[model samples]
Target: MKILVLSNMYPSPAHKTFGIFVKNQVEALKEAGHEVEVIGITNPLTGKKNVISKYLRWITETKMKLIFSGRKYDVIHAHYVFPTGLLALLFKKITGKPFVVTAHGGDIDRMAKKNPKIRQWTEKILQEASHVVAVGEALYQEINEDYQISKDKLSIINMGVNRDVFKAYPKKKIRRELQIPDGVEPVVFVGNIIREKGLSELVEAFKTVKEKRPQVELYLIGASRNQAYREELNQLMGTGVHFIEPLPQKELAKWMSAAEVFVLPSHIEGFGLVAVEAMSCHTPVIGTEVGGLRYLLRDGSGVLVPAQQSARLAEAIITVLENDDLKQQLIEKGEQKASENDEKKMIAKLERIYQQIS
Candidate 1:
């Protein structure tokens, strides 16, 4: 199969971590013996304010590349729904090509909700796609209901964990490199440092957890680009709270394996990919009950508390840490759950989707 990947989220020298899952999927496709090419709207990982200019760049780049390239692709795969996928739709109109759209949250959940015009436009794009891929069940259901997309046209396929990169590492060696004391129990949180990510609640919960277990340390690992929110989080960090800049995937896996527990206190998650990555390291995850976390952490695989409830999040974290039997149970089950969403399985499913559409 020959595939052309269209997205605004793909990684570049400027933004190494931007739309990394989409990059991973493209890599998996290539590894599976499919020829793939990508034409994306190149921009900074952050500080991208001119949406109109970005769309114009994407349109011009895609048009120039498609017209000049001699290769004819069997399918065009899009990462986001509204703009990038809409670009695919435009290409199809021009060249009569088939295209697939993968909704990675935000486009449907955030952008669609921005106004009625975008909502209608996005729905039209989804309706015209050859097929639609939803990263989570919640988003899948939302698209099905909001846009009235048929079941035959839609499928829920999460961006899977890369087991090779995310599997367990030597915790002691990682701790040594990170300078984390051996006796301390570190709880890790990896994501954007934003208010919507529940960093405030995590900080509050850590404060409560500290009162009970003084040995507990909070390790926040992510890009602290939101300076105002970073200041707020700094105010909440009294002691035993360490903040580190975003590490690459290899380094992040080491930290994930080194920590006693991983927490995802997001107010809303499209797929909770970080939780799956943590589970791939055999680390117990404690996530809030909202969005995709509800399904991902379901069935006792990990701990879940009400969203934005600091005390409840604190209680869940304390229970997982203090209870040896439960901690082990979560670890064992987490490994199993992570395996289900491994790259191999996800890639195979995507291959099947491509075959179906082709």
Candidate 2:
């Protein structure tokens, strides 16, 4: 089968970590014996939103590529529902190809709520697609509630963690490479440094944890290119609190291996991919009971706290860090859960979806 993968959220030479989940699925499809062609826009180092020029470039490129290319696609798989799916909808009209759109949170929750015009378009896109994919069950429910997409047309298939890159490593070796001090338990967070990720609340919670456990350290990974948010988090980056720029997947897995616990306090997440990766590294995770975390951290595999509640988050972190039995249990169960969502399983599910849609 041939697939045309469409999205604006693809990684480029400038920004390597951008929508890498979508890229992973594309690669998986290729490995599964499906031919795949990608048509998308890549952002600059700043990671800015699409402008008028970008929109024009994307549509024009899509038309030129599909028309000029000799190969015909069996399915058009688009990540993100609004504009990228909208473009796919246009291409479908032209080529008479069936398309599937994957809703990755922001489009359904944020953009749909911000403007009626986008909401209406997104509704049409969801309704018209041959099939839809939601990264999490919460988002799947939201899509059903909001747009009334039929059960047969939608499925929950999360982005998988690469076991090769995210598997466990020797903690001491990784800690030495990272230059983390001995005798200090590291609590880590890896994501965009933004408000919605609950960075402020995380800092507050860490402060509380610090009072209880003096030997622990906090490491904030990922890009801090958002100057205002970075500045806001500046005062808290002292003593045991550390900030590191975004590391590649292998490096991040080492950090996860070194960490005593991985904390994700995001108010909203399409899918908590990083938490799964951390779990795959035998690192127990403490995440907010919101969005994908509810599903990802199931069956006591990892600790989940209420979103934006610094006190609860702090308590959960402290409990995980202090209790050896609980930590070991979480690590053991988390590894099992992580294995269930491996790339092979996810790709197999996707192959079924593609067959259904095609």
Candidate 3:
């Protein structure tokens, strides 16, 4: 099958972790004997002027590709529902090609609610697409309840954990390889370093934990898109907090493996993929009870605290660090959850969706 993938997010040298899951899916398709062509935004710079220029260029180039590409694609798959899906919808209208749009959280939870115009556009895209994939059960419910997209047209499918890249390693060995100092318990968070990701809350929570346990260190791993917000976080953050840039999957998995506990204190998440990756690395997860984290961390798979509650987050972190039994339980259950969402299984499901639609 020949597939054309349209995504507003894709990794580039400047932002290797940006939209990397989309790249992973494309690779999975190729590995499954499907020819995949991807058109996406590689730059993650976010000034207003830069955003406008990049989108314009992306749309123009995508239009040209749809017009002049010699080989006919079996299906068009879009990652985000609004702007990217608009292009897929255009191609479908012009050539009668079936298109599938995968809603990856922000497109629905944030982007669709940006304004009435965008909401209308998002609705049209979801309504017109041959199929829609919601990356989380919560997102699937949102589309169905808010947009009235039929259950037949919508499916819940997370971008699964690549166990080969995210499997467990000896924590001490990984720490040595990464040069992590001895006598420190590392609590890691891997995601955008923004306010919405609850970095401020994480910092505050870490401060409390640090007060009690001087050996505890917080490692924040991801890019910061907002300079002002980054500055704000820095002011709130004192010692014992380290900010690291985005890393490739292999290196990231090492960090996950070395961590005493992995935390995702996001105010909202479509699906906390990083938590699952941490689980695959045999680390316990602590996340807020919001979005998919509620579903992912259920049944003692991990610890959950309310969003933006630094006190609660601090307590949970301490509990995980101090309670060996609970930490082990979380690790065991988390691994089981991660296994259920294996990358190979997700790729098979995606391939089936493509075949069914095309």
Candidate 1 scores a C-alpha RMSD against the true structure in Å of: 1.7
lDDT of 3 by residue, 1-358 (tens): 9899999999988889889999988888898899899999998999899899989989998999988972399899999998899999989988889999999899888999999999999999999999999999899998999899999888988898889999999998889999899988999999998899999999999999999999999999999888899999989987999999999999999999999999999999998888999999999999999998899898988898999999999999999999999988998999899999998999888888888987
Candidate 1's C-alpha lDDT? 0.87
CA lDDT of each prediction against the hidden true structure:
0.87, 0.87, 0.92
User: Candidate 1 versus the native: TM-score?
Assistant: 0.95
Query: Candidates sorted by lDDT, descending order?
Result: 3, 1, 2
| TM-score, one value per model | 0.95, 0.95, 0.98
lDDT of 1 by residue, 1-358 (tens): 9899998877777666767778888888889999999987666434546666777777888888678762388888988898787778877887777889999888887898899898888988999999999999999999899789999989999989999999997778888887888788999999888898999999999999999999999999887767988998888887889888867889899999999999999988888999999999989999988878999999988998999999999999999899999989998999999999998898898898889887
Off by over 4 Å in 1: 45-53
Instruction: Tell me how far the alpha carbon of residue 58 in candidate 2 is from the true structure, in angstroms, after superposition.
Output: 2.1
Clashing pairs in 3: none
Estimate the Cα RMSD of every predicted model relative to the unseen true structure.
1.7, 1.8, 1.0
Error (Å) of candidate 1 at residue 19 is: 1.3
lDDT of 2: 0.87
Clashes of each: 0, 0, 0
